[model samples]
Target: MNDPQFNPETDLNFDPDGVPTEPAPAPEPTPPLPEAPHPVATGRVNTGRFEPVRQLYQRICSEVSKVYVGQEELVLSTLVALFSGGHVLIESVPGLGKTLFVRTLGKTLGTKFGRIQFTADLMPSDITGAPIFNMKTQEFTFRPGPVFTQILLADEINRSPAKTHAALLEIMQERRVTVERTTHQLEPPFLVMATQNPIESEGTYNLPEAQLDRFMFKVMVEYPTAMEEVRVLKEHSGQVAVEQRLEDEVATVTGPEQIMKAIQLCSQVLVADELFDYINNIVRQTRSWPQFHIGASPRAGIALVQGARTLAAFNGRDYAIPDDVGEIVLPALRHRVVLTAEAEVEGHQVDEALRNMIRTVEVPRM
Candidate 1:
């Protein structure tokens, strides 16, 4: 996949099945953006591919902001997860526009959106679908569930029981659901945007740590600031319903093919070896940290690396820097790490602990 964005301005060509038919021409070299920590170690490669990827990233950010008045980090992490082949778990109070944010992204990306409201009574069959009998044929047939869609909104995922949660584990990691020994593969560019209210637990089930680990990032969405809240109210007030507003404001700017190609391109973004050691040392310290009881797993280390690579691509660089790793470390490992009871009693937060821990790890000059 030529650089993931498939730039609208450029006229590079590709086969119908997404194979590059001709090599994209390298554009004239432009001076690199000024560096804060250090210069990018390697000169840019595949500039043709990286341009479109950057363009698409900017366009999505521009379009999604039209209707969703949430944090830039929420949008950033969501796109990072989308292009990195990862899932996101969003924690926020109800009515803070969590569903609206996901729906706006689905519309802007031009991908099919499936929403499953997870309730205590929701069964496993309801999520992954179940076998149905065809009366005329007198045979059973499989019907796929909401998990089969391109962008799935798992609303209030913590509301469902563990049995229901087990259904998602296989699909999240393997990207397929098995029923009666038959596996159904999901189409490409599939993402699960699961939401939960952190303050409510009366009738909710806590997500198992393993299930939490499956998510690439655990984003915490906060209430819009006073001015931002005013802007949302001003821009959204209308006699037309919310769906109609979405139709008019948020246009389909990209699709699944482009997204998958971007994912392929993200895998190509370079990570320096020192950065690899940088990532490893951070994860290892989490285990021995005085504040954390349970440290991150190896998967957390992988997430950090992948997220850094993808974020680097979004920034139009073919090579990743230490800033890229710093940007992803907190959200990437927040849910994966657990705080000790003493630390929790001392009013320590996971994010704070991670920030302090990473400071102890040496940052690479590159």
Candidate 2:
């Protein structure tokens, strides 16, 4: 007990200077800074921003009515293709407003549009452009072709040979044209509304399967109804001045910026896991089906998701639903799937097969 003179209590109180010292106080926590605005939020329409898009759609319908008398469904599908950032193939007879539809869409959207009239002698370089040698620099400067525009009207695409069609397919898939080893990216919101005369197969090279797969939709334009025919006559039967007056009355509804914004908003629409599984099952069934030689490619699946999102946005929905997938299934997969000879001989149409598949496949519940 006497040796415990070097006691624990005394030792605990002593410091290096023989004095007690307290512990340093803890530092105060720093608050976090506010976050910046999201990149996706820049041009997108929240809840209240969709009225302008609906109004724009209405104005487009009205303007297109001036030139195109009937075929409201055709007009809507064309707009769907445009809004989805996809290419369209119009299969119809001549004098069915195919050219008019493309031109009117270009005007309505206020985007740079160009028409490439396909012919037997048309070359790939003509549509994709060629490099020219500059006299001053002695360098071959790359020049862009008509496919560089926001809206490209490939009139009678099948009329051209397979080699010429390949050039367009390349552009549609890659969105970048290569000239003299230099690659140039096409502007955003690019859409190709192509038309082919179904009545004329003579001397026309049929589009290869690879080329057809690039298009998102193969729309068939049929004859107008009797009442619609009368409307067409009344609208266009007058003198050229009257038609010009009617055309002049049509105004621009939306611009390229608005279209880009809409496309951005469309991408923001959510697709759940169940819907993705549904898409996977549909695409897999195409491969395993005995009725077809070729199946839908990976690109087809991408188109399905993108097209559904676009339809969802058009319907003013913030999230994608099963109905959106059903709505776009035909257009997204029709051109991608190649039917066998037996299926064709059996008089089975692609649309019918697609509809049957859609009906058989169960939609997942939310």
Candidate 3:
């Protein structure tokens, strides 16, 4: 009533409650830009924090190359199995540098290396050690054999009797040895690289399926190419030169601690759901496929995935692709499955049948 023209609408700077009386602003519209893809969704996982993995991978290959000539695939496969925390089986004739390759790997990794020459007369006690009475202390002492080392090369493993071969099954799977009712644990980074002669079967015993399943990979070492042969001949002209070269040229690039670190890093590699489906399809086909009498076990699928992760790390990728699985599946399952009599009569090989399975499986769209 102070001013007749003072209308509430025009003088509405203050409300009855003394709160500001401005009209609410319009809501901002969200931008309509396209959504960004998730790291895993895009198929390329991030390696932002794992620089050491790629660095160590390159360093190891470079160091192993100095003394060990070409066989890049062999070296890579072995390294994959190593970082995967699994054992390797190398099959070839005598004197193809199988022993040298293993020895060089041991030296390169700077681990405690031991060699056991498997023979028909070899006993489990010889490999896992036996308890002996200590004359000085008048007490029983447990002495560890070659199995106590970080890397054990079981040379000519097939020459050993079944009983001796069975000794490794427990230790390989459990990473521990039980002796005289006492269990001893193997140190981390333990690996066994066993070699066998493929040409000779007269005295060799067939590795049982249980023992075969324990191996992560059964690599078939073939004859060197003409160029590679020439290089080997030039490098190993004399035994003394070879030994000196291995000692001087092949430097220790790393140790067990670094290896364990790499193994841990490998476990972090990203694998998408689609890739898992692909692995499942491939493994499932093995069971139903007519070519195989005994198909790959579930463990084989897991091994493939683990090895693929390591391979992905080696290639400096944070995510595993279908190619990585394809590259490692053969080695992972070659020893795990057996061909049917019909397939064998038709001259089908395990690797060939596995390849066919892969080709038949549908690859997920990236």
Candidate 4:
């Protein structure tokens, strides 16, 4: 019987005189290493797929920082919402650079920017535009409004009447506006960055729950740190005109195509099967918790997953992990959940509720 484990080359039987050995057999070939998939191409500028995404992200941060000064969390969270294909609601007092930040982002991406100073009398037509009869042509022509742009800064959005707010509902969700029974599609990569003053409730209409739900994150832009304030002052201490020129001066880091492609890439990020259950578990618990009058909706769960994937990609990973889900749960769910009167009386906060839920839920071992 032949020896199965025997190798003619390695297992040679040498004669008493070593010189009497037969020639050695050929050696076995070494197996090749498996190759990884190439990163997805981003756009016309093929600066190596994922590398440009990360580089552009960092470049935007650097360029925006030149004028916006500090507020890294505010900037990053906004990017997360953008890349996740969701809108953002910013709560801050006037002069916190909320409008400037949105404009800077728009300029940085080379996308069209529009700003609507939402007031008590700001009409729906003022935002979504209307059809006007062309006397010469004898036909009604559809006129596009600022909302038709890629990035919209709805300044003091809550100050507008509920009717005006309602105008945004369809477009925010469906990305299309209807006027005179005709629907028009908005340009791609449309994001609404609405601002509100949390300290003042007078003359401000509370955002409808549906409107609030449309936002993926409700970021509170606070006063800058002492150092940041100093830097901001120094950077803008130049001519007021120069200060206003920052957005215009910003070189385009990317275009609408790349921004849209990056968003698509983020959507395609891998979310393990177990993570879906984990996300659902967290969202489901919000409903049954004793302190809550309203829990996060199904849409909130989807937002959490999407936001997590964006974060994972921002960190240069194709696959999402538990930490990715955890990092965004609070911001993504904070505005979505409402506290009961009893809980509010007890000083229970939505963030606290989320923290407790995080501690209670069993994080699946990846």
Per-residue lDDT over 1-366 for candidate 4, one digit per residue giving the tens place of the 0 to 100 score: 112232322323334332214433332343321221233432122122233344557667866776677777789878898888889898888988877788788777778888999999899999999999999999999999889998888999989999999999998999999999999999888888898998898899999999999999888788999998988888777776643676366666667766776777667667878889999999999999888889999999999899987876665456667788877787788898899999899988778877987799999766
| TM-score for each candidate, following the candidate numbering | 0.91, 0.80, 0.86, 0.84
Top candidate by TM-score? 1
Which scores better on lDDT, 1 or 2?
A: 1
Query: Tell me, what's the RMSD of every candidate?
Result: 3.5, 19.7, 17.6, 15.6
The sequence of per-residue lDDT tens digits that candidate 1 reaches over residues 186-219 is: 9888899899988987999999998999999999
Put down candidate 2 lDDT per residue, 21-59, tens digits, no spaces: 332122233332122122244433334233233344555
lDDT of 3 by residue, 193-227 (tens): 88888788998899999899889898988888899
Task: Point out the higher-scoring one by lDDT: 3 or 4.
Answer: 3
What lDDT is obtained when candidate 3 is compared to the true structure?
0.78
lDDT for position 324 in model 4? 81
Q: Pairs clashing in candidate 2? A: none
Worst 10 residues of 3 by lDDT: 1-10
Number of clashes in model 2?
A: 0
Per-residue lDDT for 353 in model 1? 88
Instruction: Give per-residue lDDT, candidate 3, residue 341.
Output: 98
Number of clashing pairs per prediction, in order: 4, 0, 0, 0
Which residue window of length 10 is worst by lDDT in model 4?
41-50
